[model samples]
Target chain A: MTKRSYMAVPFVLGALLLILTGYWGYTQNESRKNLQTNLGNRYQMAFLDLSTHVEKLQVLLAKGLVSSSPEQDLVIFSDIRNEATSAQGDLGQLPLANPALTRTNQYLSQVGDFAYTLNKQRARGKAPTDEDWDKLAQLQEQAGALNQELKKMEVTVADGAFNWGEFRREANEELAVKGRKRGQINLVKLERNMEQFPVLIYDGPFSDHLERVKPRGIKGKVVSREKARNIALQFVDKGEEKWQAVYRGKVNGKIPAHRIEVKPTGAAGVFADISIQGGKIIWFLNPRTVDKENLTMEQARQKAANFLTSRGYGKMAPTYSVKQQNIAYFSFAYLQDNVLVYPDLIKVRVALDNGQILGIEAMGYLMSHAPRKIPEAKVSREQARTMIHPRLDVQAARMVIIPTETLKEIFCYEFKVMLNGQQFLIYINALTGQQEKILEVIDTPNGTLTM
Target chain B: MKKRIGIIITGLALGLLISFGVWQNQEVTAISQSLYWGSKGPNVVQLQQKLKDWGFYRGKADGVYGADTFAAVKKFQQRKGIKADGVAGPGTLKALGLWTAETRTTARKPGTSRGVSNRGDITLLARVIQGEAGAEPYIGKVAVGAVILNRTESGKFPDSLNGVIFQPLAFESVSNGLVWRHTPSADSLKAAQDAINGYDPTQGALFFWNPAKPVSRWIWSRTISTRIGKHVFGN
Candidate 1:
């Protein structure tokens, strides 16, 4: 009878255990479903908001296309701008893959910027041209198409026939299959139906024609990437018998160049921006701190000038020197006929412990180094000296090609003076006798910065 | 319970009276001698100048301390929320920017102090102020001093007073033999003191330079925070 009771007890315990496990699992599944529903609701809201914004943007663009009054035009254009902006913001909030949305996003951003530019021009009492109106019409059509696509997707989502979970999972899996690295998970594939979505070209900031200034100083036979890498290796190569340079591709900027990163064996080296045409080293940097400083600023300055001279930079004069921690940096502008050419600037950073060249940048030299007619100062130093305040005790003076606040180059008489016993540099416009600017030579604990 | 409450009240009253005595003792510096109706000599002349500059006195330069000067002193003292006893005392003088030697918060003894380090950070501050902003307006000098102080607080820069001052490629004065050889002048020391005391005219500038220099492309890329004197302060 006791054995029979034991068997019944086991049976009862087994049933209870099975029921508990099933209940726990059901609760967990229910909570997970609840969370997913919450996520889906958020995505649906974003999608709905996105389509609504895009539809409004299309309507505003249509209004902009026909508006004749500059006052009404300004108002319509501003609305179009705000609508496009909010549409982009709504699109950004959605976790949609960007690959499908990059060009579309760009199109919206440009439309906004274009509208902004038109509004500004109208506000300035200028009339919009025929091309601008045509562009606005074209923008309205493209926005309508994008709106249609978003609306269709919204409908499918609302019907519960489409699954966002599956779409997101598939996109991630697609990225993995394609072997795309970091940040690619956020990219979703859009329906590929943009065959002739006109690459909108306008006078806005997003315009493709923004940077057309060819490299002014990069003049020589065009070299291949391999040759450019070889030049960089030779230029930075010192003491190390074997040094390899990694070729990072071209810089997609106003003046494109090949980027080469060099790391010597067991020591960090500098990056070199070599021109594709001349293969000149435009810039270099290796910020490995030299913890022990044995050399002073004078010694470091001499070492930097020597390094540049060895690298075929002819007759460079030290313009400024600053030392911080155990490193010293020197700016050396090219010298022609005992006159310092400030535009052709070359910067050198020296590790002061052993005076090793840590970095060298010559972007100014490489980009603005073409032979120029250095203009003679219209105002003589003596005449300019007379214009300064009586409290300014003149020290040294030079004729420098100083850049105006507007970034335009102008010849000026640069004068160094002591005011109230503090050193100051004053630049007077050589032609106009106008005091262009004054710089107080500020001394700090480690280095000095002119303020 | 009633006895304990009475005891507590009596103890509190005694404590408050003793503390008040201590506070009064501190406030009564002997140099703050109360002056009235009839005083004379150099101290009066100094007091008269301060009151006149602060728009309290309209009298001409005179060696004697008179009724007009006394009245002006009283008015100035009253305006500054001090005892209107017509005394050119330590507290009142300090308020008028005519602080005396015996009662000066900024009368830091001239020495190499390690406020943050043994490398003479205070001296270095003074030297840099003298070297860089020696001729700048007093406020501008303070702004220049605060820039380095701000740098020491940032994660990108060195954390110590010595590290910020002696950082390589940082100060032209350091490299160009200005800071190392500079002797801190009176104004420079005061500027450094003001800056150390948290008077930042730069509004937390990490970098400053004249807009006239061939400033690097990287420096120009920094967002400007404020402009003081000829220097553009940037963060």
Candidate 2:
């Protein structure tokens, strides 16, 4: 080839490279603009949603101050709760790590919680007390201030003066605060304004200082980790051949417990939770699946009884059985001195295909299995029988303690009777002779249950 | 001693036949967080519908997992002998026959599910009625079928036909192995179909039983509305 032609080729290649680089830069710039715009839209949407919800929240709290009817109070409280939650959620997505934002989140959370507790009270058909009324008035005042400040900020943002790109994920906390310090987005000052807001504590479940019930069954001396492991292994394996249990240390909860992992030979992992003081197995889960159905439910129940009896769980009566696939779950209530103690319950899941115990949950038994003095029935069976309708035929009766509607435990004479070919249980209060509860005996494919 | 030895050998053989290699792989749907009280999402909607289908929930399935939904879930969990915590985690959802997103696409086809949907329900119902009343006259069998159908319609009982039949301890034959052990007869299938088609042979009987079976004295007080074959029907 000629030297002139070779030189021409090099020049053409340089021009081609320059064109390609220009095209690439143009596309990158285009995409960058689109991406930032998309993010800005989301931030703007959340900001608007947050500001408007806070306004609605203040209005609802004001309405709550005037609402006399329980029905109207429920509606106002529900709106307050919804507004508080959505505002909190939107603020979290704002990508602002300013400690000022943390106060906002906390304020919203307390608002939501306060509304929740009031609504729950309304659900039980109760009216709010004077204290709740005062709290609602204070909340309305605080929310009104916050809503005004947010509305001012919203106006500034709508005027195309606010830079949402500054609060992007890439921006640091310092940069976000720089705007707040300059009185641009004065959320920081607004947050500090509400710092003296009451903590909004209530008798709701999440609040601290609530009466936490201690486990009554945890009455023995603290056992060694090794001993706990061995106890767990015993519940895991019934055969004479000793199995192994791996100690997983202590777990702290309402009831303190030692954890153990018992993966028996030729079996799946079985996680066990044993009480630290009594060394009792609170719960154990054998995460194994069985397919074919080999043993009958009766055989499985017998196996469960044998397992319990061998482990010193005395005279347990099977209360309910639930079957899923090839596994049959039996919940046995511990019988104490001929009385069926429903509180002390243990669940045993047997693999019907192999007659192997797949899982055992003894939380009920562990939490409430304390020896109690068997009180004689104040009302005799003959008297309790009179509480029933004349047409009903009596079948079986027992003395038992059952839970009441308001969380009280009542002792009653539980009469299991036949009502129109179906079975029903009538629990008559032993002391008062009033019918405490009547449960229809529902017969399922697996077992009988009183509902 | 020889007979005892023979019995022991027979038991061992039976045990081996029963237990050898019965493990089947279960499809576990991953759930990062449990769906509990105050938890709201699409997943909660999935949970509500499943529990509703199983005769648990009574309210509208409006997808808001509210307090009524929580109570229904707790009742279902109690029936399943589980924690009864009212949380629809992976295990609870699976127990109620809901498939996760991935399983919905990969494990099943659109047409395949609809094919087996009520076919299984009807077949199981037919088998139950056949086993319970096969020995009685054809009218008695239809009456038995009618009772189950009526239960599905009754607001006091479960809504679905399968729910009413499979409700815990609903039928003695179900617990006693007569239902599962027997294949459905043609007459029983026809009776089931007739019952589903709104045939009220027993004049809206909620229950029926053979008087010779030595039931509770309360059975006699039901004011026996009709008697077909050896069975007495009652509302």
Candidate 3:
């Protein structure tokens, strides 16, 4: 090749090398820029999270100040403590490239120490007095200013509008001042007091449930039924009085359950159960009023009979005591075609001497009260036979009017199906063609099972 | 001319490589310093916020690693059941919700923690006593307090603190954490602190009440010794 051509080739190669160098340099620069930019973005997000937590604490403290209840106070204090701990954790995880933030964190720690001491003191029962309050207020004011300054710095970094170099220099200069404020938070008095107060109503369930339910943590322990009953009565009386504030008219049988038992008041002693519920007397088994003052066994049976008559049961009959307990039974009869359905039993246990109503079990009354209206067979006894799984073929299904309550009616197609070598009575909603409830019927070949 | 061109190419290549190496070195050093000192970067700022949420970093979340930030780091370590080292290294940063830059692509969810539970009334009582008098000077005094609680549980001490603490040599502060100038931390509170800090100054000792002023040594003699605080921690 000619010398001129060789020279031209060298020049061309040099130009190519220059282009490659420029691209590599540009890529490297861009990568570095991207890293810095990502770092900055992460910093802003972290700052925002920190400030938001502070705001949350401020809200909690404000609420606590207004409420002044031990329960509320404990909850808010616990939240504040938790938030502070979390904030500290987050800050530790970050790359605080700027030294100023490190100093700011130290200042926050001091303030946190003060707050913690305050909470502990309040928990102990001895809250900070006026002088302590004044000092705390001063500390809070300083913290507020620090928070504002941090916020401003955060905004500057976040927006990328401020001169980063200048901000860094200024932050460095302010570092020393922040450090001086660190140990200045002398909250020992508050801490010592917090260390002393025994706050019984604490952060979770015990406080939350009792407060939300508005149930008095009644201080009592009654072992006997009579005592439990007396407590129930007292609870009803007090509840009645409390209900006057905004009386939602008393609805019968709408009382909240009264769960009574003795529990620890603190470490010292257990409080007796005298808690009220729904402005009603519940769970204090007042058998005397139910058994003695109320109707006698014969009288109650008569009353129950009259009650059935008032409701329209035409052929229902009452049978007097035949058992050794002198219990009375009330029965009703219904007929479909020529078959007579055996009536449900209303067993009443009465005191033999005075004939007081000891207990009245009226279950069959619901079944007997409904009219006998069995619908025409929807899927003939043969069609329903198809829906039953082959493994559990239907043995027999009958149309029957099952009385639920005296006032309610259930025209059911009761199907007897054998499942896994066992028999089950499956009741279908004759109207909807849906299975409602099932019962496992245990009947020995010797007939041990009864309804 | 060819030799001159070759020399120039070699010189340029060497200079470029050296410059690239210097830049790389500087970038690495800057990152390491930024990370070590918890520089006011995005991750640091977020870390600050997370710490605040978890009740650790109480300082402004400005992303700067000043004294307050370091103290907050220490506090976080204390809370996280880690060594209370102030430096925010990889472990501490990960804990604080910051990932090592190298760990960026790994995709981690931040700031979830598990805690310990102290169960039962008797165990709870032991925990509270441990928290309060764990730092007491006399082991016997701490043990005496536990003994009083034990005695209360037994048929011996009056069924209440007023009865047991008021009894002769039962407690140095018949009026402590409640009546005295300082109230001890609650049983649950102490348990929480212990679960986090592992500050088991009480050892396995159950009994503890102060004995700085006086205590019936006979009560102390009935129990085995375990050191906690200035008092004796005993069962």
Score each candidate by Cα lDDT: 0.66, 0.68, 0.43
Q: What digit string (tens of lDDT, one per residue) describes model 2 on residues A179-201? A: 44432576666767777666554
Q: Tell me chain A's TM-score in each of the predictions.
A: 0.62, 0.63, 0.34
Question: Which stretches of model 3 miss by more than 4 angstroms?
Answer: A89-103, A125-128, A151-158, A163-451, B1-235
Model 1 TM-score relative to the real fold: 0.45
What are the per-residue Cα lDDT tens digits for candidate 3 across A1-451?
A: 4587567756766785787588678878888778766755665565567766655655555554455566676676677667655554445333322222333343344345445656766776866566545544554444455455455555555566643333323323443323322222211222232234222222221121222222222223423444444443332212112221111111111122222322222211111122233222221110221112333444755654554444333344443232122322223334454223333333333333344333322223322333344456565555545555677868877765553311234555678888878877676656656554566654432111212
Interface RMSD of 2: 30.4
TM-score of each candidate structure, all chains considered together: 0.45, 0.47, 0.27
Winning model by DockQ: 3
Task: For candidate 2, write residues B73-150 as lDDT tens digits.
Answer: 889989998788887766676677664432221121111101111335556678888878888755567668877775
Number of colliding residue pairs in each model: 18, 7, 109
lDDT of 1 at B140: 67
Better of 1 and 3 by TM-score: 1
lDDT score, candidate 3, position A242: 24
Interface root-mean-square deviation for each candidate?
A: 22.6, 30.4, 27.8
Residue B226 of model 1 has an lDDT of: 54
